[model samples]
Target: MTAATGKKVLERRLPDERATARLGEDIAMALRTGDAIALVGDLGAGKTTLARGVIRAMADDVSLEVPSPTFTLVQSYETRVPLHHFDLYRLGSPSELDELGLDEMLASGAALIEWPERAGDRLPEDVVAVELTHDGEGRLARIAGSGQAYERIARSLAMRDFLTGAGRGEATRRYFTGDASARSYETVTMAGEETRVLMNSPRLVLGPPVRDGKPYAEIAHTAQSVTAFVAIGRALAGAGVSVPEIFADDLDRGFLLISHLGSEGFLDAEGRPVAERCAAAAQLLAAIHARQWPSRLEAAPGFFHDVPPFDRDAMLIEAELLVDWYVPYATARPAGEALRAGFRAAWNAAIDRLDRAEKSLVLRDFHSPNIIWRADRKGHDRLGVVDFQDALIGPSAYDVASLAMDARVSVPPEIEKTAVDAYVAARREHGGFDESSFAEAYAIMAAQRNSKILGIFVRLNERDGKPAYLKHLPRIRNYLERALAHPALAELRDFYRRNGLIGGTA
Candidate 1:
């Protein structure tokens, strides 16, 4: 099948209502705010059933009641991306849709319109259309779209292929919330089998070189491909660290079917850090740091990826995000070149201290969100680590700082101190552990990480249209203040105060 827009139309054979529901859920994964889906089918053709599937999937609640909108005209759902399920069959006329305010709804969220033909010429031109027909005991679905909607359709088809290749071709797919990055996830479930997570992390495209002929990703040592995740995952598993087991993978396409680590995280339901889980996570970090890390690790046979050192350049570039985005965002003016130069010099001087500190595999984001708490496992094995693709060879204290001063959840001062003490106590067993030097490094890294996060959250809101992250800015700012209290970061603290970036000091 194909569309007039020059894009291939995807066709699927849904054997039953279950299969139809799975199809809807898969489609939901590709949906973004403002996209419209037109469901075209005859009466009792499972149109409403499929629409319910999409609503439930987006809500991440399988049991969410999604009543047919046939009577209500339209049923709107408050999902991660707001959704409006419209049944236009009872509309008095095509012009009546204007009174329903659909354009306004689509501007803010997605719309799933059933019986779109009832609207006549009022239907959106760029909408994705799913045509359903009875195929013997099963149903046949043909999906077509144009523009961004077409791209989404293509990605959905790709996801289907990936799941089929992973031996879960007929499994139901449920949309999983995505993170700050371009990566996405889905929970795939097969009858009589344990659930698995589908990680859809496509290879990052390098933008026009912005720094020394390198893109921002390269300058910041961000993972450009899934090879890093595979390699680092294997390395962690080899060391007996609790990580999700990879069941299948398409490395080039950046798809992986891994074991689900349950939804229980290190933070409680109220968003406060759990003390026991936090201590375990710190101990896990100590165990990881105790191991001798290699410069290059094998991602696959004959494929080795060199672990890039978190050198002065990477540190300085990350800190520069403050001046690059946050400064202008907070001050309404860009930093002058002299200000930028001074900022760079100050960071360089502080980051230089990392050279003399102990180095290890630094899992850059070892916070509550990424750490899964496995009560069934023992000791460090109870912590299931995820999102380590950006791991680098850097100061051991970097990961500690990441854990102790997590960005996503509030870690009270006492809890943070306990975590720090737990990590230091664990490290002391290895002998020759200098707590003082480690504390200095932790403070420096904490300040750097928080500074980077402030800018990142602002960029997410201003540039990416995601304002939810801004809620954590004050928390991050507080962490930065605490870190600056250390005398070793006195100069950096003074610099921040001088620039009026933050107030007060140790």
Candidate 2:
């Protein structure tokens, strides 16, 4: 379908579940309250799945059940912005839709319609039509939107891949402005005097380094964004992680002079060996889990209660990417409904088990890249952590999965076992241990983590336009497969393999 102004219709092929979900996310972000999306596709053609991704991303706190909406006709969820998900298959006429206040919803936030053809010309002229068609093993979506907003978002998605090769295509500057620097227009500073005073603060965050004859910091920083970075870095340091010791942070102008952690993380200190790394990383996780978190740090777009039970939704969403992207592209066919149903059942059961298990502090992103190696005040090698603002209360095992089978780096087999054993031993030493139950919890959490990573890698590539993440897909699949090797996950392992995910195994 042509856009109203006859601008070229943007055509994108969603090669996997991840790409489809990303398309949905991009479309969701591009939508204003008054916008509308008409989706047309066949069964298992990724209509409801894409819709689910869009709704969830847009309204992070609301529970978005992307069931056909075929029976209910429309499902409404509370969003930071309002959204109406309409499935028109059950509706016989436009009148049936009008009765549901379709027009009014279209005027606010967004109205995403599946089986939109059933609604005919009743949709407004400004509606964006996203058509999904199955290709060889993947799917192609043709998108036609009302205006430049859609093009802008689509363009942004086209460019952002977590592991894109597009690094500093242009030169950049780094700065090392120290403490007591003035708020120059080119600098970033936090000017609120009411801010806490520090006695003899030692670290400094530097910037505007020269890269290929250009000032990298100057090229990258804007007044508003630099301010945000300093604010967050300070917050994390205050929250107790050994963030690069900031000698100074000026948010108002745009300069932060901070200390740098040494290049080697605990993960890379080969001389210390695997067993040592795991133990140190585990201890760091424990400390982070013990801290009191500020309420505002909870993830966005979804409500506290609505967040996937113990990050269950996150796992399921990632798995869906396998269905949406990897399976189709790798195998050249959509995953069967029975296969999806079985996996979903496994996921739901996992979530239920997690919810029923003991809850502890969760460092949601406990992995290699986020860690810095340091000798604690006690003078032993310790783990310094970053990227943990999304931490929450969860099963201790989740963090275990994150470190033991990290996606970014490989943990040796013996080392992984040692880490798990040490963590369990620590629990016992602490005197509140249930050995058998803890083992079960760890296995279950491990399975969930692997599945979630699989989904995320795909999402990063296909949806976020960051195909660089695909390199990690094999590792993630290997992790999942290994987790499945445990006798407890036999059924889940078979199910995932039969459905075309074997860590590039196929």
Candidate 3:
């Protein structure tokens, strides 16, 4: 008989049970919603041990109880990625596979089948085959598949090679967290509790043209590569900001092994803002804005990243997200040309007023989520900043507004005032501060950021299949109302109120 026609994806020699478990951990990173991975071998092969590694990694618990389902025929786990371990050795009859509910399991999550031969032709067409065979002093494991599952495995394996070059080949990899964008993170842990972050921020693949034949990412000045993060991290560090140090990097491939900052944030147990930490974050922003920043930054000796200007066009494009996504979602109808015209006109006029405002390097997202609190550190160092890749030259007050009106949490009126008052007091101490101009800029910037967020949250839910952000809509609505109260936004406030976006009838 001819050998299997499937393309072999990976071949690795597992020298011991630890190496075998590590391979399973790598495989776990590639698992998707409907994947079927067949663990093939004889009875004494390390099939059950490999499956346990996958289960334990996904569950993020080293001692998770993952007993073989040989007697029970199947055992399900409620990990981050729901998984089912199927041992079909004693499957009795092929017809009994129906009761095993492979299809039903695949409909929700993925499955790991121990005896693929017993399932016969009932196995999925896209099944990934992992065969274990006895080697001279160890076991040889082979993985093969096609379609999305194969592509994912290929990507994960490539990352493993990258890790090997970075001297973390034997480290355990598990999901750390993910954000709204394509970027995801994994915590790579070496022996003896040394941990680092593996930032998998692939070069962006922009979407279809949204305006002027340019994708929204381009118009919005989104970071196209890991260079943005690298450049900005260095820039902040030089300015005395506490940003993570990049330990290793494959910039072209968009992979970075960075220091893991502590996990403490400004939010309390109930997800509410902590005033003291927020005030500290405010002081951090003031110190940042006190200095002048260059528009271009050197990421490496020769490689450079130009920090994009938050010009009128980019500001207009961001504000229109409210018109494009939030307006329709709110009114149950697409915004007409007249409404869009009114909205853009109001925003353009407000942006025109920004030139008179003080200028500095603005971290476009200076809210609570991106700020890591380090209580052990001293003044300004207490805030460990991350996610400043989209930093731009803009009004100095924008970051102050961001902390006062955090996008993720509800900063009550008193706490919001505390943040702003702290920032104002710090800027005054730094000298050459214009309180009146800063107030005007703060109101306009707050309103502008809220408008963009209102639309982005809706877009994330409808277009990106992320509904978790939708819950923040009401909180944003209130923040928008507060920002509109400033007399500087009288005209813009009128437009929003007319559309029932805020208070007052048209």
Give the true-structure RMSD of model 1: 2.6
Regions of model 3 farther than 4 Å from truth: 1-8, 90-104, 117-127, 146-148, 504-506
- Tens-digit lDDT track of model 3 for 1-506: 11577565678889988988888888888787899999999876789889988899888888988888989999999977799999999998877889888899998788999988999799889899999988877899988877889777777777778899988898889988777777877889898866888888888988899889999889889889999999989999998898988988988988888888887776887888998998988988999999989999999988899999888888899989999999899889999999989888889899988889998999998988788888898998888887888888888888888889999988999999999999999999999999999999999999999989999999999997678999999989899999999998899998898788887321
Tell me the tens digit of each residue's lDDT in model 2 across 4-102.
667447777778887787677656545556677888888889998789878876664225555667778888877745888898888888778778998
How does residue 19 of candidate 3 score in lDDT?
84
lDDT of 1 by residue, 37-126 (tens): 999999988898789888988888889988888888999989878999999989999998999989999989999999999999887788
Q: What TM-score goes with each of the models?
A: 0.92, 0.49, 0.92
What C-alpha lDDT does candidate 1 achieve relative to the native structure?
Answer: 0.87
lDDT of 2 at 162: 13
Model 3: ten consecutive residues of lowest lDDT? 1-10
Q: For each predicted model, how many residue pairs clash, with residues at least 3 apart or on different chains?
A: 0, 52, 0
Error of 3 at 433 (Å): 1.9
Ordered from best to worst lDDT, the candidate numbers read 3, 1, 2
Candidate 1 regions off by >4 Å? 1-8, 15-17, 41-46, 59-68, 118-125, 134-139, 504-506
lDDT of 2: 0.60
lDDT of 2 at 149: 51
